[model samples]
Target: MNLFVEGFAWIFDPANYSGGQGWIVRLLEQLAYTFGATAIALLIAVPLGYLVGHTGRGRDLAVSFSGGFRALPSLGVLILLGLGLGIGFKAPLLTFVIIAIPPILAGAYAGFEAVDRKTIDAARAVGMTEWQVVTRVEIPLGLPLLIGGIRSSLLQVVATATLAAYVSGGALGVFIFDAFATRNYPEALGASILVTALALVLEGIFALLQKLVVPRGVVAKELKDVRQRSSRPLAAAGVPAQEGK
Candidate 1:
């Protein structure tokens, strides 16, 4: 359609890439906000999540807290922080940190919980110290889920960082908001397209990361389990089941 062409043309325009407030600068600013927030959130969430998961203590409380935290509106939080702290990068950073925490926390603890009890016990039986078991066995086995949590948190932060422009913190959202105020539909659409493309690219990168980090044996076993589960119903119904890859 004409709108899509106009939007794409606006995005690819050479003029938009030259200024300090250009697309590249805004894109980098957005990425900085997202990555910074994610790192901070991970530091705070991962240790607490691991402790709760490892000890099976305070898990319910942590889960409840994460649920409550996730329900808090990012925009509202940003607004309140801006009001109290007087709008700047600090408010947006804090807002992003808050938004990024819950998923990472939930993922880390859930990863810990998902590790097989038998495997953990076997590690203990093999004269592994508690620390050794956690470091060598648990963390490796739980890595997929941990990475999954990080991915979720990263995606959320990236998406929400767009709101940074609302608080005068630089981000790609400036294009969208500024365009709307000026009735520049092409620019607004272009910004949105860039945001979506960025998110998808990030997602693909993380997906590749997940694949690389998860153990090969674990991947094989999971695949086998899926195949077996799928065959069960067919067996009961006296029908041949298609083979799984």
Candidate 2:
């Protein structure tokens, strides 16, 4: 459609968007808010997640609570908090923090659970203190999953922070809302595209992080062992596995 084309064209117009008087500020501000909220959420969620996951007590309760919190609508919570707290960055930031908690908590819990029981038992049997077992044994094992939770939380925060615009908190959503109101199709499309691009960038960074943290050698070794086992029956039956140099 010509209308859509024109709109996208305006978005790329550096002259119009020059002097940074346009969506750039909103994007940065929203990114800041989202990151800040996620930071706070991580502060609270990561430790609690580690503790609950390690102890195995109250984990179900935490999981249920985090799930409930995550399910709460961002706009609805923002509106209520903004209205109740007199509308500003504080309420929106808090609302985003709530949105960010669940994934990190869930991830952390999963990480803790993934630590090998036999490894834990061995640590205990070797006269390791509870603190040593957790710090030296459990946390290291859970780092991959814990990092996963942080990544999830980061992505969720980035997406939801757009809702800040609804309360005059100003974010990319503001541009989208303005475009919708004035029928400025270009701005709306542009804003959406930019937001999506930002999300993708965040996801890409986290993917690299996961690869860096998870030992590929371990995975490769495991796969090799599995293949060896599967070939054992064949080898016993006079079929040899391929030899490696």
Candidate 3:
């Protein structure tokens, strides 16, 4: 109980931050590493997913490979890479990328596949190039799923990123690691609380993004029941107004 109180006190110490002279730099550093890795992973996964799903080729291979990647323990992979890479954030960043890609890729592919075939055929019939069809038709239709996948990836990466501090990559992990090392249970618990807060914030942002990016049609579909109920009264009154007009 004493340790917890002291840890909370230390967390409020301004000097722990980069601007102040504390370990806050470690948190920023880890954030950079995780975001960078996720960016790279998404770049590769998104396009590949689109291609596989759109072409209806090697989809099983793609999905299976992603599953295999997910099956590999991140810590185990990081441990091996740390031996070769010489203990830094890179190895763990790579591990996170591997872990994060599967869902994004699978979601993108599934989204593309879910796009109506008739819609695609219509696009092609209207003189859309294959590229145009993909961009204008398939991707737009699949965007909801793709965004959901990305949101999931972002949440996953944020949670896993705390582990980066394990190899001196610098992150919120430092607080936990150092606290535990010195038997400071309060500090360790504080670090966990911060990480959880961050995860929740990330999830919230993605949820907002999903809502903002989803097509109006989807939104309309969601409101269809409400619309039907509301319209009945208005429609009944509307006839009287129209007659007056």
Candidate 4:
């Protein structure tokens, strides 16, 4: 209780809000690092993932790479890269990008895969060009999953960005490692709280995005399933089941 109180107090302390080392500055730096690395990874992964999913080519390779990257120890990768490349933005950026790729890649291709093939064929049967089918039909239908992928990547990149401080890479992580190094537990906890809150905010935003992108039919089916499942128990109990939610 005391620790949490002090932690919140630390966050609100006006003295901590001034100059280059201020919470706002650090938070911005963190966002910059996160967005930069994620953008790079997405540019590389999404196209490749889409190719695999769309043409059904290179899926084995995508899965293998995704699994490998997900299995990587982020901290160890950062340290090794630093040892090889020296402690600079390169190491941290590479580390962030590598770790960030899998979720986004998986999401991209998996999103496409999740689309019904018959729908895609129907689009083709309608005399839609390949490009038209992809842009008009596939992408729209696959959007919810694609957004989900971005959400996962954002969470991942943000978390991994914290490890950047290890390589003198800047971000909200400075508060964490720096504070812990000095035995400032309250400050560390406060910084950690900020990171958690940031992640949760991103999650909430993307969750809404996912919901918004879901086709209405899919949502209706999901709701219908839920209502039916709910009514089943009542039916089994010999209670009158409500109809038409």
Candidate 5:
């Protein structure tokens, strides 16, 4: 379409790259919101997730809560918060964090559940303290799943951060909003393209992270048997598995 062509053209325009609100500036602001929200969510979710996973209590409750949390529309929450709190980073950051919690929570509990019970019993049989077993055996084996949750959370947070422009300003979403408000279709398309590309870049980064955390050899072994396991966590959780690896 003409809009796509024109949008690409607009993206490369040298004049658009120099201002304080330029692409790089906007991109950085989005990243800041993303990291801030995710960091906060990690603090809240990781411990809760780990506890629920390690103790095996309240998993049903956690799953139910996460499902509900995921249903909260980020932009809607941002608007409501923005109206009440006024234009500021607080509202947007809180909104992003709210949307970031679910996947991380899911990943945490699921990671623990993904581990073979026999492995855990074996560790306990060897006279390892509960803390030692958790730290030495379960945590390492479950880490990939926990990181997978973070990866999913980051993806959600980054995408939601774009809506930050709706409540405040300084993110790439600002361009799209400004362009549409003035009927600048090409610029709007360009801004949307930029946002999509940013998400893709981040997705690739996390994908590499998932791969790096687990050993390739172990991952290779699990990859062959993933289909055979009924309760196996998704590969997005990471590669090296505990069953045999």
Candidate 6:
């Protein structure tokens, strides 16, 4: 309790708000690192993932790569890269990009896979070109899952960006690591709180984005499922089910 109180107090203190080393500045740096990494990862992963999902070629390879990438340890990779590249933005950026790729890739391919085969067949039957089918049918229907992947990747990137400080890339982790080294518990805790808060904020924002981007039919189907699930309990208890007019 005292630790949390002290941490919150430290965060709100006016003295901590000004310098280049300020929490706000560190937060912005962290956001830049996270966003930059995610954008690059999306550019690389999404297109390939979509291509694999659309063509059904190279899928096994993509799946293998996604699994392999996820199994890697971000910290170990960062350290190895730093040793090889010798401590610069390159190491941290590579580390962040590597960590962010798998989920986005998986999401893109899996999203397409999740679309009904019949729907895809129908699109083809309608004389749509392969490109048109992918863009018009698969992409729209698979959007929810695609965004889900982006959400997962974004969250992972945000959390992993803290490792940037290890390479002197400058982020909120600096506060935590620096304070901890000096035994400044309040500052360390405060930095931790800020990181957690930032992650949550990003999560909420992405969740809203996911909701907004999902196709209307998908949203309707989800709502219908929710309604049915809610009515199941009433049916189990022998209550009369209400019918929609």
Judging by TM-score against the true structure, name the best candidate.
Answer: 1
Candidate 2's error at 27, in angstroms?
A: 1.6
- By lDDT, the best candidate is 1
Candidate 1 lDDT over 48-158, as tens digits, reads 889888999999998899888877889999989988888779999999999988889888888888888999999999999999988998788878888999999999999
Candidate 4, residues 124-153, lDDT tens digits: the string is 999999999878887777777777778888
Stretches off by above 4 angstroms in model 4 are: 215-245
Model 6 clash tally, residue pairs: 0
Compare candidates 3 and 5 on TM-score and give the better one. Answer: 5
Q: Compared to the true structure, candidate 6 yields what TM-score?
A: 0.88
Write one digit per residue (lDDT tens) for candidate 3, span 108-204: 9999987768888999999999999988888888988888888888777888888877776677887888888998777787777777877888788
Clashing residue pairs for model 3: 15-22, 16-22
lDDT of each: 0.89, 0.81, 0.78, 0.83, 0.84, 0.88
Residues 133-178 of candidate 5 have per-residue lDDT tens digits of: 8788777777778888899889888887877888775688888889
TM-score versus the correct structure, for each prediction? 0.91, 0.85, 0.82, 0.86, 0.89, 0.88
Model 2 per-residue lDDT tens digits across residues 26-61? 778878987898899889888888889889989879
Model 2 ranges with Cα > 4 A deviation: 1-4, 215-245
Worst 10 residues of 4 by lDDT: 221-230
lDDT of 2 at 194: 76
Residue pairs clashing, model 5:
none
What value does the lDDT take at residue 46 in candidate 1? 91
- Which regions of candidate 3 deviate over 4 angstroms? 1-7, 18-23, 221-245
RMSD (Å) of each candidate, 1 decimal: 4.2, 4.8, 6.6, 5.0, 6.8, 4.8
Model 6: residues with Cα > 4 Å off, grouped in runs: 223-245
lDDT minimum window of 10 residues, candidate 6: 221-230
